[model samples]
Target: MTFESHGVSAGCWTGTLQSDRRPASLSVTHRGAVVVQAALREAGPGVWAVSAGLPPSVIDNGVHSLLLVVGDSVLASLTLVAGTVAGDDLLAEVAQLRAELDLLKREFRRLATGG
Candidate 1:
């Protein structure tokens, strides 16, 4: 939720940082390479805005995670997934959630029936 101004979309990422003082540095990295060397600016008192453009190579199918760094600390991240892989991932997650929900419902019914 740090990225308030804009979330990852249109091959770009945006985030916000709130601190009492300005950070020494800010950047975005992918696989340890600096994609955004310095893309931070003070938006208001104790608030800063950061943004970066995602590379085309990392935009392909699979999970793409971008790290947002403030000073030397890894503050936030943006993750994108696409293609059939993304669909499969979502389906697996949904199946797991459904299993858990079914378990909860059964437990609730057993307790309700005083079994």
Candidate 2:
């Protein structure tokens, strides 16, 4: 995940990017824990980005989390922000898995028939 900004802060994980620039303040939480926090900065307009380098284990298990706070107030918060599992990459992986399953099924059928 890659986040770029001139003043805003963003959080990225699992191929999904979550950003908040309402007041130029942003916070990121993972598994109900705060991971990243960035203060607002004036950069002419408003531009900022945050990227989270998620480990393979996290992705394989399919987990996500997010949290935002503004002056002791919860502006936005979400848990399990799972993106499209049928996306291009996931689709390709699913296709491969299906093909393998098909092959195994064919082999099993053949063995059963022979027996």
Give the candidate number with the greatest TM-score: 1
Question: Per-residue lDDT of 2-113 in model 1, one digit per residue for the tens?
Answer: 4454787687787777788777777777776777754678888888877677778778777666678766566776666776675777677568658966997998899999
For candidate 1, give the lDDT.
0.72
The clash count of every prediction, one per candidate, is 1, 10
- lDDT accuracy of residue 2 in candidate 2: 21
lDDT of 1 at 27: 75
Give every collision pair in model 2: 3-49, 3-50, 4-48, 4-49, 5-47, 5-48, 5-49, 6-47, 6-48, 7-47
Candidate with the greatest lDDT versus the true structure: 1
Candidate 1 at 30: error in angstroms? 1.7
